[model samples]
Target: MMNCIEAHGLTKQFAGRLALNNVDLTVGSGRIVGIMGPNGAGKTTLLKAILGLTPFGGELKVLGRDPWVSRDALMNDVSFVADVAVLPRWMRVSQAIDYMNGVHPKFERAMAEGFLSKTTIGREQKVSQLSKGMVAQLHLALAMAIDAKLLVLDEPTLGLDIAYRTQFFESLLHDYYDKARTVIVSTHDIDELQHVLTDAVFMDGGRVVFSCDMTDFDAHFHEVAVKPSDHELARTLNPLHERHSFDRSVFLYRNADVEKLATLGEIRTPRLSEVYLATISNQTLAQKGSPK
Candidate 1:
């Protein structure tokens, strides 16, 4: 598979305090990879490092080119939208589109028009007057227009109501991520994107603690509902995560011991989000790392 992004020992620091430790990452072309972590887990730092937005330590590459040195070349093939609003609030919707076209080589005017038309954002409205959600959608409009090979969205759906979030992601998959572009989204809501994801990477304390592919999800991890009596045996193996309600328990575990677990009651396949949370929280407990 062609790799659209690569990183080796990528590290970031502010005032000598480590924000991102030495980390390695690889993102393949034509895949949508979801990145999740609690606040300050280094999700945004990693994305900015990949985009060459913040100066940092270690090697980072996007589109097979070093982002630190070849940012202009990298930007030609990649696009990004940080959580904060970027466009000048004073600019009108039409002005933002015109400026993007002037700045990016791959900007498509017609693409931006069609995207904005699907929503209520008028070409005439000043960005300053637009609601938070409208600004996000406007940002999405420009991103989809860029014709980039890879897109990185940092909590793009944040501040939007449920309906807009649904419409936005639906438009992203159907219109932008069809067959050509790769996307990596950093979000807190893992379950929201679980269905459409091709792969997942979970970050804890700036390190990737879990990574899995969608096609292998159910086959690799499972949840079991068992009697409270089995909790002791289950604890020995260090289950991913477990919960108790009343006298019963639900345990999430890797699929490695599926056969042995047959004796446990009512085994069921887990959703990606469930498995992800279980793994990270359990790993944290074992490491004595407090969740942020």
Candidate 2:
């Protein structure tokens, strides 16, 4: 598979603070990859670099072109949607559609209109008159109608209710995703978004701590809820993370003996959130010179 975005020795500084610290990342084509991290982890900065919206020191490429140097040409095959409230509050829905038609060469007026028709939003309604959910819907429709190969979303569903956030990703999965297109999303709704991701990347302190394909997650990571009697035995095997749930002790392990874990208690696959927590925890431990 070809990579849609590539970065090597990517560094970005803001006010003498490193936003991206010698980052290296690769996003393969046709993959729905999630960028998971705490705030200040350089998730937004990385996305901006890929979109050519920020200047940085590094070798970075998006869609086979240097994004910062050739942003105009790169944007022809790229589309972006950020958090809600970006639209002009005074603009009417129809005017917004017209503006997109005039500005983006790949935008399809009919496609955007078709998506809006499914909602209660009226063409004459101003953005301020619409609810936050409606604004997100409009933004998503506009971006989806564009015939772009790479789509970058930076917290696109932030601040919305669960219903609207769920709907946003559903539309992307069903209405816009295809094998020929690639999407990179940075979101806080990890558990909700994990199901749609083909790949996952975890970042911390402006560096990528862990990355893995969802298909290989089960092979690389494992979780077991050990019985009270087996907690010490499980610890002897060196679990990456351990937490208590009533009487059962759930342990997360990496490249562990699955068959041996099965003898401990209930062996189960780890969720993305679990794996992410373990990744960050391990990084902290390693930095502290403690055993992971």
| Candidate with the greatest TM-score versus the true structure | 2
lDDT of 1 by residue, 19-103 (tens): 7888788888888999988778888889888887888777777887878787888899888876647768899998988888899
**All candidates' TM-scores?**
0.93, 0.95
Q: Alpha-carbon error at 62 in model 1, in Å? A: 0.9
State each candidate's clash count.
Answer: 0, 0
lDDT of 1 at 182: 90
What is candidate 2's lDDT per residue for 97-150, written digit by digit as tens? 999899889999999999999889999999999999999999899999999999
Which residue runs of candidate 1 sit more than 4 Å off their true CA positions?
233-238, 289-292
Off by over 4 Å in 2: 288-292
The whole-model C-alpha lDDT of candidate 2 against the native structure comes to 0.91
Cα deviation of 203 in candidate 2 (Å)? 0.9
lDDT of 1 at 193: 91
Clashes of 2: 0
Query: After aligning candidate 2 to the native by TM-score, how far in Å is the CA of 202 from where it should be?
Result: 0.8
